[model samples]
Target chain A: MKLKDIIAALDAEVVSAEDLEKEISGGYCGDFLSFVMAQAPAGCAWFTVMSNHNVAAVAALTEVGVTILCEGVEPDEQLKAKAVGRGLDLIVTAKPVFEAVKALDL
Target chain B: MSSLHLEFDVAGNNFVSAGSASDEVKKTLKMLGVDPVAVRKVAIAMYEGEINMVIHAGGGKASVDIDTDKVKIVLADEGPGIPDISLAMKDGYSTAPDAIRDLGFGAGMGLPNMKKYTDEMHIDSTVGVGTTVTMVVNLR
Candidate 1:
């Protein structure tokens, strides 16, 4: 699935769009940055309620396809700036983590 | 001898910029044509050490030496040193306050993750003094 399709399916709003055309191999949901760093599959969309700046770092370090902030969570200002500055694809959705993952049906 | 050497001052308690050094190192490794898997390993290990410095030590110094075969990361800090290295190595052990945990860290995975991703790990810490962690990830 392409990032744009997943965004449309979840009705997610773009927070910092780096690559909407990137392919999404799958998804990994977690809030713990270290856990995500260790376990998140490369090129998979990361679903989490974590809104802090470290989220961007973890997403970038893990090479995730895109970071999807679920449960209506919004990225903090630092995170927003970092995402844009670092070219990290970040999005937000009203659905919770599980539902957002389900909606993608990946 | 290393082909490249880089250093950074990791700001203490600065969660906003905590992983900047690691990010830079990852970029350097990528640019040097290091294997993606090895780059990811160095990135994860170094980032974990950098985060530990920010959360525990009042910031610290991180230096990286990239060679043809391996990347070595050294994180040194002057903070309340680890009382027990063995215990600190435990996967679920952490002394980080709940506030840090709320920010999505301090789950006690930092050291373990560092050890997990790297080919070599060392800890030199003393109570009431400081701590330094060294890790090396070999390029494949």
Candidate 2:
């Protein structure tokens, strides 16, 4: 689904990169960087509650279409700017990580 | 043809920039028409190594050499080396401080995951000197 659709479906706010709405292949959720790196599928929307900047880095490296930041956690300003600079779609939701994933139908 | 070589300096202080090298390598592999699976494997493996460098080893340098049949990644770090490579290779043996964990890392899966995804893996480390990891993902 498009990133915009995911935002609407999950009731999330677009933290950055609103212009990019490329279709996502699937969803993968994890907090561990190594686990996500090894398991997360490319062209998918990665759901996590982690707000670190490396999350954006991993999304960029894995070519994930977007990142859904759950648990209502706001990323640092530097991270938000970095996500925008990297052309990564960052969405934040008030729901928990699992709820966001379920909302995406993953 | 000559091997396509690329190098990157991973900065320890910038967690956000850790995967830049891996991303660039992934793009290059894609453009080179490499197999998607192999590309993903290399990308993920190297990306994990890069993150480990930033999280545990202060910083490091990553060099990748791509050939027709395989991709070779050499990651060398000057930070404190692992005292026991075997223990560090375990899935849940992390020495990362709480700060690193707070950043969503330090779960101790980096080394194991890197080894799991690559076709061949080698590690050289000294307790106080440094560590070097060499990983290869063969494309057949």
Candidate 3:
């Protein structure tokens, strides 16, 4: 599924828009950075409440299609700027991690 | 392609620019047409090392030597060395303080993850002096 479609389905807010047409292969949820880096599949949509700037680095390294900040979490200014600079997508949603993931049809 | 070497100074406690070095190396590997799988391994392993440097060693020096067959990474830091490397290598063991945990790290997966993605790994450290980690990822 394309990122934009997932965003629409989840009612997510795009804070740092990259390639909305990018296809998300799947989803991985985690707050631990190294675990996410080691375990996440490339091009998957990452769901996390980690709003720090390191999230941007992990997403870029893992090549995640988009980052879905769940449970009303939002990226801080530094994180937002870093994601934008790296061409990584960042979106926010009020849904909890499980709910946000369940809403995905991909 | 000729062998290429890259080096970067990781500033300690600088969360803002923690992964910049690994990102640069990832982009360079991609541009060099390295295999996607190898690139991912190198990126993850190196990024983990970079974060470790920032968190544990109060910043460190990272150097990468990329040859046709493999990539060699060396991370050296002058922070208080590990007392028990075996313990440190444990999957869920970490010495990071609570502040680092709040930033979403300190789960004790950094070293294990680095070892997981690399073909060979070695560590040399002195308790009060420093620590150096060497890792290699084969491209073939």
Prediction 1 global C-alpha lDDT: 0.90
Residue-wise lDDT of candidate 3 within B19-111, one digit each (tens)? 889889999999999999999999999989988889888999999999999999999999899999999999999999999999999999999
Residue range B50-105, candidate 1, lDDT tens digits: 88989888999999999998898999999999999999999889999999999999
* TM-scores (chain A) of the candidates: 0.96, 0.91, 0.96
Residue B81 displacement in candidate 2 (angstroms): 1.9
Model 2 DockQ, alpha carbons vs. true complex:
0.64
Residue B82's lDDT in candidate 1: 97
Model number 2 iRMSD: 1.6
lDDT of 2 by residue, B27-105 (tens): 8999999999888889889988998898888899999999988999999999999888899999889998998888878
Worst 10 residues of 2 chain B by lDDT: B12-21
Across A65-98, the per-residue lDDT of candidate 3 in tens digits comes to: 7899999888999899988887888999999999
Off by over 4 Å in 3: none
Arrange candidates by TM-score, descending: 3, 1, 2
TM-score of each: 0.96, 0.89, 0.97
True contacts kept of each: 0.81, 0.75, 0.81
Flag regions of model 1 displaced more than 4 Å: none
- Report the lDDT tens digits of candidate 2 across residue range A1-106: 7777788998888888656556777888888776787678888888887887778777776767788888898988877988888778888999898778778754
